[model samples]
Target: MKIFNCAQFVRNLSIPTLKFYVAQHQLCPDLMIDWSQPEKNIPKALFSDIRRLEAVQADELTSLEKKQSITLGLVRWQDDLKRTFCMANDSAINEFRHALACDPEATVVFGAGSPEDIALWVLVYREKVFRDAELHLAFQAKTHGKYWKQHLIPKGLDITHDQARLDKFCEEVAQIYQKVGAGKSSHVEVTERAQDGSVQVTIYVEGPLTVIAHFEKNQFNRLSTRIALETALVYHPSNGIVESVVKGGAKNHTAVLELFGKHIVGQEITPDVVEKKEFRLNALRDEMLEPVLDWSKHGVHKVRLRRAKFTPVGRAGVSFQIDVPPDMDKPDAMEEAKENLRVRHYFDAEYAMESATLIVYMSPAQDGKAEHFSFGIQRLGASTIKNLSSKNQAIAYEVLKALDIIDVLDGPGNPVAEEQPESVS
Candidate 1:
């Protein structure tokens, strides 16, 4: 039994947008007052009011809003006409009621049921209701980690016991670490930063054991370091070596693996063999990256950088769109500027979209008050991004990053790299 709470509403949804969602789903009014008009649309006011209600319990709301907003919500159950009446009269209930008495489309129904049954009905209908709702709100706010849950579980640390092998691997890493540090280059400074500015080769052993090796280059400063690390080993687990190499920057970089030639207690220590394998690894890596490059060149995906700013809209917050492609249906390939690799992969997996204009507005703190802040990525081609899934939004974000259309900005709306000034106003 899932219910659409206030927090979910605020995540990226607006009143009108939700109304459009209800209309799109043709969600039945929570309580139909009459029988003749069985199919009725939930009043736009209902959704608008819900958006306003969100401000009551603002702290719980995920999006950054000024006022407090509510967290609870009602799951309307259609049992019987009498039950509908009973639920509606209680002002405490934000229950959906029949539209105005004059609305002939309203239908009167009757019955009694358990909460699960009520939830069942709501779930069946609300999915489409909310799926459409989710699309409408997706672009308005970054809606991740905000969801309805029946239970909660704490995540545990990600360490396993394969002690002995890991110990040996880590020892190897330490040795490599010491040697690399000893031979530091005066021209380059190697730091333990997360960027691919350097390549890392991790060795994973077969007891399901794993080890990591890192290789870094300071192109800007002209220096490089290669370091390897191993994990702890446990009982006779499947032992195997893991290898990974990461390269960064616009230019191609190469890595040379230097493994000391020494045979282990039972295994053969082959240094030259490992170096030869490194060449194969590099070639494979290049092959894997080819699809991303091809996609970008063919225009299957277009990247753009975006600068976004959040401004106060009444008690809520609104994000304005200053630079976006003219075609909204065309997915706005956007991403954070720092995530270059992620952006590249995003362009590789692409989807076709139609064009449309989506204006997202949130209701103000008080009743009858509303604020307009963000425009759904104006799909210039055909369908609005409002039709996309959260995953789709994520990919779209990555493409945007490749284009440098991320939310990051410099002084007073200055894009990070001004050379790519977007033609869209």
Candidate 2:
């Protein structure tokens, strides 16, 4: 038997919200007290101190005070929950209670330590509760099929056809903006436009700037999209094509073209082809001009640059990674890369082993936290400087200087400064 734990159900429910459930279900709850009427339900003898909440601000109350109030208030809820569930219909009540437990609303209430937290919690709780209610209705529809699909489903009016309703709704929306000091709205237009076997919605806004926006048809449904994809590959992994679109512009045209040619040229673009294709292989490479020059300028020709990728590291920084088969596939690749990369690699093989292959990260130093750049620069020196030779160290230092992580000395004989950390990274 699936035992219904009614005591557990009412433990964290908002009392005022519970009233909606009670009235809707026709429940005769006894001990539970609503948030608004805490005094009405609880006895005068019980929670005498909590009853003084009327004089004190709930949001400003101390932690101990809130704990005392909630602890006493829960006592009443425990008694009421048992009584309410005992009288309520077994199946329906249990389902609703299960939904409440599963919802994020109750989870947030327990997680909240203060009134400010509870305020945000309530907003989240209410949103999730509405969604949970919709889910419950869906469950009800499975058993009550015919009635659920017909009578229970109220027909909604089309916005374009119902001018009066649309006007009234727009007026209310405008009033809401005015009431909240969001300024007045001019008007709302909902006209449909047909172009190239596709429907485009025209939303005309007569406001401060008279702005207009558009939403295109779903790609698969549009004629132009279909025609453009006519020679598209036999649905091999679409990641490359998708990535090309994401990257955009003329720069990625060759990669996009090659990717499509490799995948599509002679193959099908059906659903089954898409399902059968594998996307485990590496993405097509693009040799960037900037990093190629950086490598040439570095003058470290021993470790041949196999492939290079420069990715945006943080808000305002770039991470340049170069893969050298010689640097990686060696028996002591890590040791070799580290020793050759940093001037200090000879003194610390462990540092070389840790920093090798990861290369350098060029991140913007936070204001007043530029001091930490020394540590990051030290890490790069461990991983980035390939050789202790005069020319090689100069090249590595040049790269580090450009990133603003370290200062460049006038000559190669000048020693690099020691690092310091003052704040959290």
Candidate 3:
């Protein structure tokens, strides 16, 4: 059958995604963890177990083509692999979340899983979940041609009976599209009306993982259409990943006929929204222009504010500049670890809490084996983080005032006075 529509594309792509992973030697056959789960507290023993199968680099996904199943596997997580058994799982996601709760400025957390196995999956978790689920439903449905005839229109072209409907839909999609950013980091947005009066959205994103998916503006009765529409969504802010259609600008999706329903346009350049879809279009377009982009592959440990001078206008941005030291390539694992921690201390000591402004001060090095330094800003993406604790907020506000990121609008909000060194270092 000639496949044409976005739904057909998603349905075709996702139906066999799981069977693809079955061929890989399991790290732990006792466990049945999927792409949705975080890889934390994973056993150290799995390193050798995983390394023997395929050289799964950090955040790497290997897909072996199969006639029936889409065989795929995420490789081992990177860093401290030889020494640490506590790699990935629920514990790590939670532990990191808690630390950020206590110290929003803790710089140790954000860069925890640069190229971990779960990194690729978690980065695109939402994209996979809904698409996988929808494709599963499409695989299940065997609709009668009459249903397609009723929906396909005045001319008797039953959509479910032939591939022409898909072709027509795909053509319609090509003519109306928008992109917020350019490159691998950019998100391709498309919106279309279905025969059942529901609007669907297709977002194509290329990263360490490739996600091309579609969904409803909002949930509609499944009986209304055989396609399975999602009723829930989970948004993860790590690196500003957008998790739902509404988050992608699908407000009032059920209303239909809304032009440019999904666009990457965003107004808030505030630190909090910078990673979001709207703002990402402006800042990270070219970064994602490729098929694979990640820390292990790119040499960028993290993206954080290195230096900024605030003004009434938008915030200034500089490279956070974290890197492996030139000498870190030493064969001595212990020595390498010590060097990693030394780099960590340099930045973590200054911005102890994980706040939006907390810099990921890796002190950009020429390059080496040094483990990257992280400040747990990713935890702030938790929906639970409503506002900074009064104390931390005050602290952050003071620091922002010092940096002049924000003006001292009132009493006590003023930048705290600091004593200067007797002489320059």
Best TM-score goes to which candidate?
3
> Model 1, residue 374: what's the lDDT?
21
Task: Write model 1 residue lDDT over 1-425, tens digit each, in one string.
Answer: 13443333222333333333334332233312232232233333454444454444344545433231122222221222123222222120111111112323211211332322222222343333222222223212221111100111111212222445434433443443343242211111111111111111233222212344544232334233333222111111111221212122111111111221111122333211111100011111121112222223322232222222222223343333333443323322222212222222332232111111222222244476543222233222111232233334334333333333233221111111111111212
Backbone clashes in model 1: 82
What does candidate 2's lDDT look like per residue over 94-121, in tens digits?
3334445666655555354232223223
List residue ranges in candidate 2 displaced over 4 A. Answer: 1-159, 196-282, 286-309, 312-316, 319-425
lDDT of 1 at 282: 15
Ranking by lDDT: 2, 3, 1
Candidate 1 residue-wise lDDT at 279: 9
Top candidate by lDDT: 2
Compared with the true structure, all predictions reach lDDT values of 0.25, 0.30, 0.26
What digit string (tens of lDDT, one per residue) describes model 3 on residues 1-425? 13233222222222122223222323334234343433332222233344444443222464433211211332232222211222223333332333234443333423443322322222233233223323222211211111110011111111121234333433333333323222232223232112112222333332122233444334442232122122211112222212223212332222111222212111212111112101111121121112222222323443333211111112243323222332322222122223343342333222222222232222355684433322112211211111223333334333333333333452122111110111110
Candidate 2: clashing pairs of residues: 233-264, 234-268, 340-386, 340-387, 341-385, 341-386, 342-385
Candidate 1 Cα lDDT to native:
0.25
Q: Estimate the overall C-alpha local distance difference test score of candidate 3.
A: 0.26
**Span of 10 residues, lowest total lDDT, candidate 3:** 144-153
